[model samples]
Target: MRSYAGQPRPRPLPARYSRQELPKDHLVEAVLVTIFCCMLTGAMALIYSHETRAAIRRGDIDRAFSASRKAYFLILFSLLFGMFVSITWVICVLATLYAQRGP
Candidate 1:
């Protein structure tokens, strides 16, 4: 066995779990969206991300996958909603300015 000078490698997961790729938890994205986007949807995404991490810890593959999917969708929805609102606000502001200019 070869040893590196850096931190030691983590112990291998059980054969059952290690055999296949794990789903993403999306915890970071959830947190970011919660901070910078729609709070309600972002909060929901954060919850789903927590659930995904928990299920992953328990080695419940199906549950983990489901929670990960939910988290991803929530994050996406929050980003889209935020973008929609931002664009709408900008358009309204520009329209107001144009109206005030009395062209």
Candidate 2:
């Protein structure tokens, strides 16, 4: 075994224990997925609000009521999507941090 200065040199990994590397596109994939989810949520909310307003203006009580329900549901879905994205981001950040620290 060779030594580096006063310390022993680090040993190379054995063939049987070689690590499996992730693809370079993994980060891009993660970011795109997050953005897509957010955009979908925003689109749903916007459509719901616009339709609800139109229904109200047209004096269609039944349509307005249904639109109101849809608006609330869209808002709820957006909130849930936001929470999911945040949680996923946090987990990814933590995983990266831990991975960088090595075993």
Report every candidate's CA lDDT. 0.87, 0.55
- Tell me, by lDDT, which candidate is best: 1
Q: Give the per-residue lDDT digits (tens) of candidate 2, residues 1-103.
A: 9766883443443344323421111223233433555667456555655665565445444564575566566556666777897899999999999999998
- lDDT tens digits by residue: candidate 1, 4-82: 7994444445577754578898989999998888999999999999998777777677898899999999999999999
Model 1 C-alpha lDDT versus the unseen true structure: 0.87
| Model 2: lDDT of residue 46 | 58
Query: What CA RMSD would candidate 1 show?
Result: 6.9
